[model samples]
Structures are given as structure tokens and as C-alpha cells.
Target: MKKICLTIIMGLVIVFLNGCEKVLEKTPDGQTTIDKVLNDFARSKGLIDAAYNEVYQARDQIAFVFSPLESLTDNAFWAATYNPYRWHNGSLSLSDPVITWDWSSPNDQLWSDFWRGIRLANNAIKYLPQSTVITEEQRAEWIAEARVLRCWYYMQLLEFYGPMPWIEEPIEPNYAGWNELVRPGYDEIVTRLESELLDVINANIFKPRVGAVDAKRVTNGIAYAIRARLLLYNASPLNNPENDRTKWQRAADAAQDVIDLPSYRLVPMSEYKRLFIGANTTPVDEIIWRAWTDNSHINNTNGVDVGSYPFASISHMWNCGESPSQELVDAFEMTNGALPVTYNDATHTTVTVTPEAAALGYSEATGGDPYSNRDARFYINIVHNMYNYGVPYNCTEPYIIETFVGGRNGFNDVISQETQRSCPGYYSGKDKQVKYWGPGNSGEGNEPTHWVLFRLAEFYLQKAEALCELGDPDAAATALNVIRERALQPRIQDVPGFANTQEFLRERIRNERRVEYCLEGQYRFIDQRRWKILNETNRFITGMRITKGGNGQFSYQRKKIRDYQSYTDKYLVMPIPLEDAKKMTSMLQPKAWQ
Candidate 1:
């Protein structure tokens, strides 16, 4: 006889043993006495709460550094401006590096956390079958939620590690051979996710409404969002391009389903900038699903403060960790509906701009607009000439210099110490909380902000991109216009230099995604991977030179140079941390890449 100690608290049961308990346990009733904990409404809620814990754990544990790595590969940031040694200097390794420092490889942690989530979800599924505490419909809904969330966890593994060992069952000691599991191929993982997700979605088991601080918790909309994103990624150029059309079509359809649901809508134009800073709730209209957090033990603050503030905010104000590269900054077309070069062709010759030339609204003698006539999002996201009052220390407010410092009384002297100072053509105001001054005691206050995982706008953009990619120009235009109209930006036809062709539409959709989704943790690198544009444009950086004038004025000039020396195939898929590869034994690096 084996003794199994089962303790039921809330709705969860923990199985432990006094000592050396065998797998076979007999109860006094002559039934197999496996540790069984009955789940009531309270226990179910407790389990749900436990599942939500993974979001915070994932963020603080693995996501912080890993997420930034993706952005660093693209033009979003340079080594010099933020901390230089990390991604910019190529110092980050599977081993040791700088910035959000992590000594252990992220692979195991991410793997463990995701599985932990899966286990909790599995418990929910298993218990839902026999539990009599809740209504049948409610129980079924809970199961659907668990299944969707479980699939989502798997999706994360799929995206990062490629084909991971797929585990649907909760781990038990009886499964002794499970440790010898081998990684599945990409197709196997995809097939399982596709099948499971379809069933989960069709079951319609979740409460239709979004939850509060629980926004980060998995919901039906989130499942749909993940399916759409996964299918789209599979269809994009990054994976096998053979199924590009079919994958994108499925992606579009998934996104459309979310769009059709009245529960989600775009956050109004007025709330756009505030959406990321944690000011607004998941705007019911704009958010489909998000990992929820509140003021409790898991206050869900994201990396926006670390990424946006440039040596100013008190709590986390260091120089901007990920400054937008000149290339990305220039991606925005002039508000006047023309490329910067069209304004003055001569500026194209030089990369740096003299102070005199900069004030005149051009980056260089050749031509670039550092400040004037660009998309609204450009100004909203990139910090250029704005003066940030350093809270209590007003005098310490950093003045952004867009040109080189030189000569008597020049603007350059004001901001010369910062690397890539000349490129501060714009500061990211997106998600900036106005009340946050400088660090604590410096008069700046920090607030509990939530991480927004899903917004309705993202679905719209996803659909638009997919539609355009699938060669449906008109439908793509309609999708894009839906978002644009909400933003109050001119429609495609109303704007000048607009071509409604597929290629043009594609570019337009891409640009829209870049602007709309900047710093929300999605950007060109992922886009490049999905579009298979990494090889063509990954290393390109558009830069400008700044010069000072005698009157202490600063100016910027544009240079049309695409520098690609730093990028390599290894950069495409991050190198498997050497330690992780050694531990796994079977892990292989992505071929023909780095």
C-alpha cells in the first residue's frame, strides 16, 4: 500500500507523500487512492489565477531581454545611443552580456514556464470533466479557455525554438521515458496546434466579454489572434514559402473572425498614444486579448518606460535603450506626400547635415526632412526636438540636438555626450506617461502599468497585410482604410502619391504596421522574417549628419547610405545559446544563417 497525501486548498490539489510513496496507492474504500482534489468554483478561480502567473513570470524571467534582441536586429536601435555593448556591439551571447543582464540561458526558463502554464491548463481540462460545482456550459467554457491557453503556450514555444517536443499530457512520474523526448519537426507542431485551435475556437467556451486586470489572461480572442499570427508567420517568407498564399489566406480569415466580433474595436484616435503606457484598459473596441495584470502581486508593467525615456525619467530614465535608427525614422514619407529626396535632390550627396541646412527642413545638402512633413505616427513615436523637463530638476531636462555640435553657442554642445546624439530627430512619445518625472525623489512618479498583449487594431493591420500579400489589393485597401479612418489620417486615395496596386498596397500596409505597432514589441525584424525581406534589407541603416551653427542652433542632414556590414545570416535566427545547445545535445543551429 502506498500512501498519497492530498491537500486541497482553494480549487487546487497538491499531491505529495509522507515518504517513498509508490505509484500505486490503495484507499480504504478499495479504490485506487490517487491524490484527488475536488475543484469547486473557488478552486477553479484559484487555478485560473495560477495560470495567469505565467505572464508575469515569463516577462520578468525571459521576455525582457529576448524581446529586445529582436528589435535590436532591426534599425529600431543602435549600439551607441542606448547601452552600446549589448546587441549593437554584438556582445550579447547565449552566455554572458550586458543590458538587462541574464547569466543563465533563457531557453530552459522559457521552456519551463510555458510548460508550467500548460500543466495548470491541463488540470483545468481534467477536472472540468468530473466537477459538479459549476454549470455544464460554464465547465465547458472553462475547458475551452484552458485548451486555448494551452495552445497559446505551445505557440510561443513553436515561434521561438521552432519544433519543440510537444507535450499535451500533464507530466507524471509514471512517464519515466518522457525525459528522452526528441524535438518534433515544424510540421508536426503546426498540425497539432491547427487541429487543437480549430476545435477550441469552434467550441466557443469562453465568456464573450474581456476581463479586467485579467486582460493578460488567455481568452478566446487571444486564441484567434495567436492562430492568425502563427498562420501568417508560416505563410510569410520566413518559413517555407511554398504555402505562402494558403497560409496568408488562413491568417486573414482568422483575423477577420476577431474583427467581426463586436467585443473588439480599435481604441479611439485620442487613446492611441496612451494605450501602451497602461493608461487605458484594454480598450474594449481595440483589444481582443491581452495578458492581464493589476495592482496585486502581479502588477503588469512593461518595458516601455525603459525603452522610451531618454536619460530623463526618474524611475527608469536612462538614455533611450532602443533609439529608432535613421533608416526607420526615414521610412515615413513626408506629410506633403513625397519622399524627402524629392524636395531637394542635392542633399542626397552627403550623409551629414550642416546647421544652416538642417533648420531649413532638410537633413543634408542632398535632402532629408528631420522634422517637417511626415506621418503623424513618426512624430508620436520618435523623440526629436522635444525638451523633456526632468521633473523636480527642471534645469536638467534633456534638450535633443538633431545636428552635430560645433562652433560658438551651438545646440550640439547641449547634447554632445550622448552617442548617436545627432540622430535624435525624434523622441518616442508613444506610451509616455506625462506625470512620470525623473527617478524617485527626483519628482517623477512611476505608476503600475499593464502590458497590452492584444489590441483590436493589430488584428486589422494583420488582416490588411495578409490581404495585400494575397494579391487582393482592393480588399487590402479597405482594411487599411478602416484603421486609417479611425486615426483620422487621410484615406489612400485622398492622400497624394498613393497607388492602389498590390506592390504599393503591400508597402503601405507594412509601413502602417511599423508605425501602428512600434514599441508594442512588434516591428520590422519579425516583419522582415515573415516577409522574407531580411536578406534584402536587414542590415540597411539610413543615417544623417548633424552640424552646428555660429548662433548655437542645431541642424540635421540626410545621407542615402545603406550600411550592411554588421548583418549576417546568423543574425536571422538568433544563435542557439552555446550552453543550451550543449545541454540539449540534439539542438541544431539554423543553417545558412549566422
Candidate 2:
């Protein structure tokens, strides 16, 4: 009996939506069959759970939903030779290891990871309806869950790869023409995905979302948010070559659907930081959807603290990587509703001082603290010179970060001598930072860190963006103000002397997204590509310089970082994975790649 059970269990392969694995009961006898497993609700549920787990599975373990791909964009710079850095430096090719399957390294194959997820979901969707052990309602709900995962996987593939072959049914290994299968165009892919999402939404299959028990599962709110984001992506210029206004309207409507959800609201500014950083037993109101973890806190053990946090924070482990660029720092507006402060050596003693310096409540004319009195979100998102790094693990007052040239955590400082880049600095806030020591401080990289995949704040900005593109600046400003109000910053109209023209409003909306969603994921990259502004806006990324003046004031200079290269048109869309492309003769590489 034990031998039979071991053989049956070993032969079984279950895929969960979250992409995590759990143990299942071994077969009582050697006669276990697919039909028998599907007939048992417990066994079928195990399969569904496996599919959910697989959604976040990268190689052998679950990874942050917001992959390090965020670093590849203008918002960040990781000094390593990974795909993110390679993509950022414009050194990526079709044959790059990231775009080509490295069979030896499971995590290196982004293409296959997502494809595996899609296949798992497809298998569940195909089998669940046929389960005799579960009632129709159970089947409907489970299938809906699987379909949502399927749509999500398709979106992931489509966004980076552009126009993947639509797979509705499970494909067998012996299926003919597998190698020659050609991907559909953008329109067909979007249309099919839209239809599938709507089917799930209208089925009334998901639950009203609440705390831990239901946190990871697909809910009504998550489904709607996915729909809203999909519409926005479809309306983007890269996908919508015709510049369709109707697409924008549809996106606005979809976003409004999320806004209309009673369960979703931007958590108060005081509670905002907790959404990303702290250990929370229950799901925060702001998060519409996220990758759920059984642990009370999301783990940041990937050296997120060491990478994004500055050395001055008194971090326990290796610190410093994924530094924010000065260009991103400049995107933050002044508290007095003025433009970003610029460098002027003649009138201003330091480059950090803006025309609205007095209004910013800073007493230092020498400008040692460059980030003084900027938009409130700046405090939440960025780590600049003299900014506080939250309460220390030792329970002291927040440590003031020093990223200036010779300051404690500066680029030229001895501790960071290996990588001497600028120090405008990027620091994740207390909510995102690990305030306590993990066992052996080995948990420094493994500290709980959760990814807020979708939040109410994003939907507000999404609505504003769609409105602006549709030529309704006034209405757009209203939507934009929702986020600004939450951030406690001056609203759109409050910026004195600023024009409300569509062009001007468009710039504001773009800048708002840049600062609002920096390093959260690929929001900056998507917005730039969607508007086709990478060539214009990201032509040359900049870094800041901090020099000690004769009178002891810090003078700043914004200079281009070395070895950093701005991306060209080709980067707007990544090439199809080279291995997959080579297998299929009809496979079309991204136009830029060709």
C-alpha cells in the first residue's frame, strides 16, 4: 500500500494559481485516475491551489510579483549585469540570456515561466468543469479563478513579447504544427482576453474580498482592476496604433468600475506606507490585488533593503544597489506648487534650492538637504540627502540619510567605493523597510516585502490619463486631484500660473504617474512606451553631484552618470524569446528587433 501511494503521488503534478506548492494525499490504491481525482472536491481544489501558487513561481520559489524588471526603467539603476541593467543600458539583444532560455538556470527563462503558468491554468480550466464530485457552483467559481490567471499570464506575455499565440485549450505534446504556430496580432489578442475577462466578471463567480483566507484568491475587485489595467494597456499608443479615443473612453470606464467598488479606497496618507512595507495581518484597503503570503509580513529577503536602502540607514547586511536617478528626483514638485528645483550656480548657492525654497520650510541656504519641502509623496518614496530612514532596528529615532558626495552614504564614500554613482538616493519607507532584525540578520534580504500590484491610487491616475488623452483636461484634473489630495500636495489647478491646456495637463499627468508609481513595478516604463516618449524624455539619464563649498554649504551639480545609455525605439517592446522564435518559423519578432 505504501509503495502504491508513493508511486501515485510521485506521478501526480498539480499546478496552483499562486504558483506555490503544497503536499497532497497519496492515492489509497494504484488505481488513481484523472477522472477519480477530478471527482473529489478536495483533490480538484488541490489542483486549483497549485495553479494559484504557480502564478508567482519564478524558478523553484515564489518571487515578488514586481520583478526586478522595475530597475530596468528610468526610475532605478541596479549596477549589476542582470537583464534589468542590460535592458536599461540598451545592451540587450534577441540572443540575450534573458530573452533566450538558459536551460540550466530556471529563473532566467521569463518566457517559459509565464508560459508554464498559462498551461497550468488552462489545464485546471479544462478539467474543473468535468469534475463530478463538485457541484456546478464550485466548478463555476474554480473555473473563473483559473481563467483570471490565464488572462493575467497572457497579459504578461503580450506586454513584453507583443502578440503571443492565443491558447484557449490545453495543447498536447504530440499536437501537430506546434513549432510553426504564429502569434496573433495585438487586436485579436486584446479582444480575446477582454472577452474572457468579461465572461468571468459577469459570471458572479468570485467572492467580495476580505482578509487572509480570501486574500490571495481572485475576487470581484481584482478582476475589475485587471480589466481596467488591460483596457489602459490596449489604449496605449504602442498597442493602439490608430490612436483611438474610444479605447481611452473604455479604459476610463473600466477604471471607474474599480473606483466604484465599495471595498477599494486609498488608505489614508498616515496608513499609506503600511500598504507596501509593514507586517499586516489583514489586507489593506488600498490594495485591490496582491500576491498573498501566509506569513504575516511580505519577505524582502532579496536584499531589497541592502539594494534600495542607503548605507547610512545602519543596515545589518550589504547595502546599496538600485539607486534612483536624479532625473526621477527632479520629477518631484515643490510643496508650493512650483516646478522641480533646478541648478543655478549664480543666483542660488546650491543646486538644490528652488525659487520656492522659503515656502518649503527649509532654513538652510547652503542646501545640504536637497529634498526639503517637496511633494509629500517624495518623503514616502525617495531617499535623498538628509532625509530620515525611519526608526532604526535598535529603536532609535529615524536616521537622517546622507547621500551627498562625502556624506556617510555618498557615492564617493569609502563604504560605497565599489560603485560611485550619484546620491539623490532612493529609500523605501518604514512600511516597506524592515524595522526589526530577523533571525541572525540573515533575514535582511528575506525581510517581509509585499508587492501592491494594484491600488486605488493607480486607478485615480489611470482615469486622469485616459481623460487627458480623450481631450478633457478639466475632467482629467478632477480625477488627478483625488490622488493629489491623498498625497497632501497642491492640486492640479492650485499650481499658480500653470496653464490647463491639454498639452500642459498631459505633461502633469505623465509626471504625476512617474513620481506616484516610481519603482513599484514597470509603471514608468509602460507609460513612456505607451506615449512613445522614451526617445524624447529619456534621451540621457542624469545623476547629481554634491561638492562642499568654501563656506561649508553643499553645492550640487546634475551630471550624466557614466556607462549609462538611454534606450532607443527598439526598447519600447522586448523581442520574443529567441528559443521560442527559432522554433516557430512564422513567429514574428518585434519590429524593432528585426
Candidate 3:
């Protein structure tokens, strides 16, 4: 019986989540009996936590995701040649560890890891209901958490790889072979998620929330947020080529459900950046879900590494990681609520400042203090030329960051030394919770950190997007304005010469998502794909050339950093790994990959 139980434990592949540290006293007893796991509340709860651990971070899992998924999008560029560059550099293939999710190397393959999570959840859903020791209330709550996590994992799978095989329960040991596990249709996946998973979660089967103590743990809010996000993706032009208003309505309604949740509210503008820095340490009012671990905090780990990544003089990072793009820099509106540069095309030429912005005496032209007087969010999000960067991990105060060729944080054209100096002319201030650790430490104080996943702000944007798709730009404007209000920017209705046409409003909402959520996650990467605008947006990552003159003045020239040669169709959805797909005889690759 002991041998049989050990097999079940090993075969099930259950690993615990973020809070498991408190659950364990010392090294886990490898010889513990399975009956304890089944009957003991703590052990059984750990099984459910395993499902949460399997879900990888889309933001920054340095070794796991190479660079944050932003490297694959126009938001930022990762100077070092890592896995993300492999995809756009034409070296991506099925054999890559990222695709295969090689267990030996502990990779983050969307395919294998998600299934492993599903299987773990299947085991939890199976055994948790049979618990003899825990109360019915405890059982219901724990099991509900597992169910939502399983569905959320599937939602991510759908986002990355399109439709997938639907599995409701654990597979029997001698169940149907791999050949039987073929892909299903997109509609089938969506319907099943809506009817089976999302409906149940929305009905509040779980606790009101996981709460502040475990802010990173999955919650009912997260389930609702993911449902809305998935529906929005489903209604996007890429998925809803037929322009189905029904899909758009569903997305809108789902987003509205999130807004109706009583426990959450957008943190005031004062508390905005506090969401990522763990500054409050209390549950952030806006955050619904976040990534958490004992050792590493989300405090701008993206550029925190002061070692290799140019810009931050405070972090102790090993690799030259992600830095923001000039294209992203230009996305921020001026303080007067107009784009600083109006572009005629994606080529980024044929540009001029908007009359409204120009009238305010703002010019992003080649040279002369262009970084000043931008949107309120711009100062928080970017570290541009002649900007001050804050809080080195080892220091208590902020420092000036220079992006000139030979300045403190140098900007250069050489590819190999990309990490030595920033590839992009500017660094993302928001992504760097701390500039560096040792090089620029003030030796005064320390800061807190956390990772925000689902926040109330995103749902508002989703509602706005869905409303825009449903031909209700007026209602969409209301939702869009909520976000703008927090940013201290003027409402859409107040912008000069504003038109509420669906075409114009849609661009406003999309750009809102771009600037508001930049460096937060893979939202921009997936947003461009879902909207089918990848070709236009992913082509060129632009940078600025800052040359300092004899008078110690810096002149700025916008230049194309690299032409992304591989922004072709296969990127619409990642290709199924060849080895993994072959196991299922009839599996279909995404249309573009095929």
C-alpha cells in the first residue's frame, strides 16, 4: 500500500504554490504517507497550491521566459540574444527549451507545463472532495480554488496556442492513448469555458477572495478578470473575423461583472505605482491578483540588475534584460492631452506635433529637452534622457540617469555591447522598481516589492474595448475616461477635435492599453496579435541617438534600432512543438503555422 501511494504521489506530479513556505517546517519527508496528504487539511491544500505554481509569469521569469514577454512586442527591447529574440531572429524551432519545456532545464513551455497543472488540478478536484478530515466548507473553498486555477491555465493556453483539447477530469492510468488527444475547435473551447468554468466561478463558489495576506494567490477576482480578458480576445478581429456583436456583448458584460465585485476599487492616483512596489504592503486597492514568492519581489526586477542591464545603477542582475522602446516612449501623450508626435504611418516618418500640443509649446523634435511636459504617467513609466531615476535597492533616494553616448547610463549602436549601454535611448522607469543596488546606493533605506497580475484598471479597458466593438463608443468613452482620470489626463470626450466614431475610439482604447499597461505583462504582445495589427506594430523598434555638444547640451535623433525580419504570420500563435504534436495524430497547428 505504501508503494502504491508513493506511485500516486509521484505520478500526479503535485508541487506547492507561493505560500507553501509557511506550510513546511523543514525539508519535506519524502517518505510521508499518502493517507496524511488525503486526510490532513494542510497537505491536501498543498496539492491545490501545486496548480498555482505551474502557471508561469508572463511579465518576467528571467531564466524561464528569457526576458519578459515584452521583448517580443514593441513595448521594449531585450538587448541580449535570449529566447524571445530567437523567435523574431528566425532561430526558433520545436527543439527550443521554451517550446519543449524541458523538465531537466526547468523550462516554461506553454504546452507541457499547463497540462501538468491541469493534471495536478484534476488530482486535487478528484481527491479534495473525498477528504474525510476537513469540513465541508473547507473542502468547497479549496476545491473551488483548484477548479478556477485549472480554467485559468486553460485560458492562458488558449491565448498563446489558440484552441486546445478540453479535459474535465483526471485521466485513468490506462486511459486512451496520446493519439486520442487531438485539438478542438475555437468555439468549442470558448463555450466550454463559459458554461462550465467561468459560469461556476462567477457564481462565487470560492471565498470572497484569497485576501491581503496571500495577495499573490489566485482569487475569485482573478477568475472573473481572466474570463473577461478571454472573452475580449475572443471578440477581437483576429478571432471574430465575422465581427460578431454577440461576442463583443459577452465580453462587455463579463468585464462589467468584474467592476461589480465589491471588494476591489482602483487605488487613487497617489497609490498607482505603489501597486508594483509593495509600498503599502497591504492589499493594493486596484490589484486583483499578483505573482509572489519569498525571495524575489516584482520591484522592477526587469531592469533591477545593475550588473549587465544599462541604466539601473542599483540592482544585482546577471543578464542585460528588457528596456523600453522609443516607439513606446512616443505613446505617452503630452501634459495637454495630445500626442507629441502625430505619425502618418507605422514607418514613423511623416510626423508632426498635434496643433493642440504644439500650441502648448511642446516639441518632441530632434533635440532640446523633449522629455519634459509629457503625460503624468510618462514620468512614472520611463527614464528618458535627462530624467531622474529613483530608489536603488541599496539606497533610499533617487539618482539622475543620463542616456547620452558617454553618459552615466550610456546609449549606443553596437549590438554586442547592448547590455553595456542601453539599446533603446530610454529605459522604463516603471519597470525598474529600483535603479541598481551597489553602483548608486545612497545607503539610507529599503523598499518593498510585489507583482500585480489582475487589477481593476484592465477590466475598465476591456469594457471600453468591448463597448467600442459593439458600436457604443459613448459608453466606451465612460470606461476609458475612468483610466484617464486616474492618470490625470483629460477624458476622451474633452480631447480637441475628438470624434466618437468606432474607428477613432478604438485607437484611443488600444493606445490606452499600450501606455497604461506597458511593462506590466505580455498584454501588448498579445493585444497586437488579437487585433491582427502585429505586422504594423512589430516591425521596427526605434531608438533615439543622443549626442552631447561642446556646450554640454544633448541633441536627440530618432533612429530605427533593428528591422524585425521575422514578424510574419506564424507569430499569430506559437506553433505546437513538433514532438509534442506528433503524439496526437490529428492535432492541427495554428492556421498561420500550418
Candidate 4:
């Protein structure tokens, strides 16, 4: 009996061991040398795949970085209705200070993650020499792709942190110490990126497929798009020390290069809203480069959650975090090359507030043609009371609104529970999935839509701005007209007010960017910075007074006019994190920041 028991135990042990082997079989071996690990097909692909992974990782975090900056200045969101944590109290230090608060050193995760991407690119470039299986042509293509990614990473850092320490080599602790490092100037970084991008373009290296989605991957078009963007930024007032006209020309040329590519095209006007809603099969012409995500990718679960309204039901939903400001809504021009009549003081001629409109919470009178004679892009991009619920509406130059909620009288408060429903406003429709609904009635789900990082439309807009800045109003007008024609908006005879000069065109271009890129998270503080208008733009709240009535009616009262103050110089470029500053002896804090 004892012998029989031993035999059974040994059999069980063998089964258990076999199961363990299967589980551990694919586990990466630490004993493998770096050279061998890189040469391994799976490992090499994995490392390359990591570059794409960083794209999604970066995309998820982009809102956090951009929201505060965008909110600080007028772009798409209102400052009065939203909390003033970052704007008033300078609490942005809690998240990142490099661009907002001046508490943290520059060596935070923003810098670290950017460098991580750069390092991965470097590793791929370095290992290409050892990759015997990959041909010279193939190797050159791979390296070019990697270089584009590295330039993109650097571009992000350059935009936010200004000049940063240039790192082309993979991190090797044994080879060097942190003391040896120093920050490169903005011009030098731009020059280096431009040089690398030239190689990327000349080599004709990139995935050929038009609609392929890979967040961590770079394509030839993406490289050109990056070059276009970098040159545009470099030509901006922030970076251009000498006011170089050639920089603007370079930007226009780069943008035009991408536009000339047949593989790129704009999405149909009818499908514009659907393109950003969720996983789309139709290839959009506007999207030049996007970080690809599907059901299996990291952060895919939270994709819809991040973009949608945080409400229980679509019908009764309130915007969660991102609320569009009245400023941006007003920026949209009428279809006939004129500002919307809502901005006209004469529109206030009717003054009747209905109970439903009161409950729905809108200060503006209801029943007037709010949607009529408006820009087509406005209807495509924004969702107001009229568009919500089962409202059937036909959008065109003459938009016919069949269903209009919150009529002139009843005011509806649309701020989410996070804000205690105190702030009432229309939500920006740029990122959220329109059809998305949840069990709790919240607008959160795994939205299958890919986030567009670069696009042809933006390139056109950039070229227009650059051309205008370079004293070529005719060229600028032509570029702007291309985008306007696609939008189906009426083209102005001469870019409104800017008949011939670059100065007038520059203003028009800036306004165009605000309208075209609204809620795409572009204008915001960066616009303020580039225009050197940060100090002049408003950034303070007088007081917020709430009045609650017995009939479930609430009112928000504020001072009509209030003075605004700008933060210190240290607030201009975010302060290096204090902890990181301690780690790096060579790091210097922004002036005037503690």
C-alpha cells in the first residue's frame, strides 16, 4: 500500500512540473545578453512594438498635460464655469510643473517618458548593425522609422520644456554620469531634428499602407507631418530669435510635401463627426498620423471613458470634465463670411425665459434660429441642446433644427457630478463617442476609435499660417481656401481684412487655427505663449455666488468685470520638480520659482 501511494504522488508531481514548464516557456530569459536579446526576432519586434506602446501611453496622458494649459487660456473651454485649481491657485504642480506650476524640476515623467522613446529609437538604430537577417535596404528603412519617432519625442519635449538635453545614444550607466550632461539650445535641437528628418524623407522608409493603425509605429507621412509641425513651431515667436522668414518657408514646404502625397486625403464632410466617435472602418483624409488602439491594446478599456461625458444616460447626460467655453463657440463664423448673430447685441431683442429653458439652464433666449446660417463645421463639431436626445436635424449652410431643448426660458445645467452640477454649459463634441451609453447612464466605454496625432488638415492650416507670417498673403489665402473649400464654408474674397499684407493674414491665420483646431486641444496656452499674449489674456475669477431656490432652481452670480493678474516668470516655463532637482546637481530651476 505504501509503494502504491508513492507511485501516485510521483505521477502528480510530474503533471504539476509539466504544467509549470508550459507557463514559464515564453518568459524572457534574463541570462540572455543585450546583443542576443536584440537579435532575437521576437525580442527585436517587441522592442520595436514598444515604440508604438509609448504612443498610446503618451496619448492617455496628453489630456492631463493639455487640459490645464488649454483651460488657462481661452480656446474651446470657458474659464469661469470650471474650477480654477491650475489657473488661480497654481496647483498644476501636483501633475506637472514643467509647463504650468513651477514646483517640480524638469526631470519628471514628461522628460523621462520622452527620453524613454528616444532610447528605444536609439536601441533600434544601434541594433540594426547587428541584425544580419534584415537587409541593408530594410535596415535603412527601420532606422529611418526609428529616427522619425525619436524626432517626434524630441519635438514634444522641445514644445513643453524648451531646450532639453539631447540624447541619441542608448542609456549606459557604466559609460557616463549625469554630471556630464547639459541642455542643448532650442535652435540646435531644431537643426538636429531637421537633419534627421531629411534622412527619413530621402530614404523613402515607412509602412506603405494608407489606413494601417499602429500607435507606436511611424510612417513616412508621419515623419513629414512631424517635420511640418516642428518647423511651424520653430518659426513661432517663442523659438525664432531672428524672426526668420526662411523658417516659415521651410514649414510651408514640409506641409505641402505631405499634402502632395496621394495616400493622404480628408474624410468626407458627412462622416466628420463619426470619424472621432469610435472605431471607424472608413479611412479619414484628415488624419495624417494616429496612435492606433484596439480592444487588446493597453489603456484600451479606458479609451471611451477618457473621451466621453461622465453621465448615466445619453439623454440626460452632463459633460464630465471637458466643457466648451462660450468664447470658442462664438469663434465659429457664419456660413456667409460673417460672425454669428448670437454675438450681436440686437439678438437680445427678445427676452422671454421659459420654465423648461430655465430648468435646462441657458441664459440665451430660446426659439431663435441658433443653428440657422452657421458654419457647417460648427454643426459637425459641437453638440448643443438642439442636437441631444432624439432630435432630428439636417445640418448644412442653412441648418434646420427640428428639436431644440432648453428653450429660451428653461436653463439646463450640464456640468457633471464631479463639479456638483454647479457649472452649466454645452460640452465639446470633439472626442466623445456620440452613440455611447452606459448602464449607469455614463458616457464611458471602450471606444474603438483611434486618436489622431497628426493630420493633413492641420498641415494645411500650418502652411497657411507660415505663409502669412512670411509675407505671402496670396499663398496663405490659397492654403486657407483649400481647407475652407473642403469644409464647404463660403470662401472670403481676401481672407477678411487681410487683403494683401502678411500682418493681416497672420491675424486671420491665428483666428483660423482657433476655429479649425478648436477642442482638438491645440490653441490654449500655447497660442497665448506663441502670441506673447499670456500676460495680457484674462486669468482670474472675481467671485462665484450660488443662489438656490425652493423650486429646485439654482442661479450662479458673478462680478461683471474683474482684474486679471499673470503669474511670475517662473510660471512661464514650468518649474523643475523639487525632488528631481535634488537628484540632478546640474539642473537649474526656472528663475523666480522657489
Please report, in order, the local distance difference test score of every candidate based on alpha carbons: 0.53, 0.64, 0.69, 0.52
TM-score of each: 0.74, 0.84, 0.88, 0.74
Q: Write the per-residue lDDT of candidate 1 for residues 483-537, one digit (tens) a residue.
A: 8777666676665567878888887788777767775554455676556566556
Top candidate, metric lDDT? 3
Using TM-score as the yardstick, the better of models 2 and 3 is 3
Residue 480, model 1: lDDT of: 90
Clash number for every model? 50, 33, 9, 38
Determine the C-alpha RMSD for candidate 3 after optimal superposition of all C-alphas: 5.5
Q: Which stretches of candidate 1 lie over 4 Å from their true place?
A: 1-44, 56-71, 78-112, 127-139, 174-188, 208-214, 278-284, 294-316, 341-369, 387-426, 438-448, 493-500, 540-547, 557-566, 574-589, 592-594
lDDT accuracy of residue 305 in candidate 3: 31
Instruction: Return the TM-score for candidate 1, rounded to 2 decimals.
Output: 0.74
Per-residue lDDT tens digits of candidate 3, residues 1-594?
000011124333322211111122221666556567777777777666666776654356533334577777888876755565665676555555343322333343566556667767777788887767788887777787778788887887887888888876765534445676678877678777766556657566665444455555556777788778878888888888999899999999999999999888988778777777654346667888766642133333355334433544444444445778888988888776787777776667446767777777666554456677778888878877767665454445565677888876778686543363568777765635443254653222435444566889999999999999889989999999999988989999888778979999999899999999987776887898899887788777888778888878776767777778556777778777666666566778788766
TM-score of 2: 0.84
Clashing pairs in 3: 300-433, 305-317, 306-315, 313-436, 314-435, 314-436, 314-437, 315-436, 315-437
TM-score of 4: 0.74
